[model samples]
Target: MPIGPQPHGRRGTVEEPYTPLNLRLVLAAFGLVVCVGLSILLFRMGWTVPGWLLAGWAVVALVDIVVIQFRRRARARAEGGDHSLFE
Candidate 1:
């Protein structure tokens, strides 16, 4: 089906802009990079309390981001496309 461009204005009661799936993907990528960079920095600082904490944070962040991204993509596919951010 041919989908047309969606208007980029607030449509709901809450004031906000429409964030497309592609833009979300880009943000997710940046988040992942930040997680990785932090993890590397922690590891480079040698094994310590803060290092362990950062490592745990990195794991949680990576998992959360990956799961969210996959769910979004899957939901988009299951429906018709990325027309709705609702999952």
Candidate 2:
């Protein structure tokens, strides 16, 4: 479906606006903070921490990359053509 309001023949509320890329960047940064916070909590508790912290960091990084990829794919699809060359 198109990303905006529906066609005139059919009506409902307008679609939600596309969020700015800065918002995604901020969310990614927040994810980093969460990973760090988890690591610190583990450390404070005197548990074996680095191993699990590293694992958590890796998962967050993977998720960040996935979010970026999802944005790229959605933008490309919205443009409706092979726009890779522009990249």
Candidate 3:
């Protein structure tokens, strides 16, 4: 397929392999796992304060992802309303 203006139609994006949103979600999930796992390991190894601190960082990343996705949607809605960009 040519990388022109419209790479896809209205529906059937989930079946597509290179969807941008899916890629972002995968990266975010990986980051969450790494942060949360490190936090658990620290807590188990007799580190109380640092473990909790690492957990807090993980929480921050989660919140950041939510906020960023929300803003992205809102901005897309405002700019000429091209819903196809989301899909």
Compare the candidates by TM-score and give the number of the best one: 3
lDDT of 2 at 87: 30
For model 1, the run of ten residues with the poorest summed lDDT? 1-10
Using alpha carbons, what is the TM-score of model 1?
0.48
Extract clashing residue pairs from model 2.
none
Q: Which rank order by lDDT, best down to worst?
A: 3, 2, 1
- Per-residue alpha-carbon lDDT of candidate 2 for residues 15-87, written as tens digits (9 for 90 to 100): 6434443356566667777776777777777775684865588587668756765765666565544433223
Q: Which ten residues in a row have the lowest lDDT in candidate 3?
A: 2-11
User: What's the TM for model 3?
Assistant: 0.52
Model 3 C-alpha lDDT per residue in residues 24-67, reported as the tens digit of each score: 54566677788899999999999989989989888977875675
Per-prediction backbone clash count: 0, 0, 0
Better of 2 and 3 by TM-score: 3
The residue ranges of model 1 lying beyond 4 angstroms of the native Cα positions read 1-29, 83-87
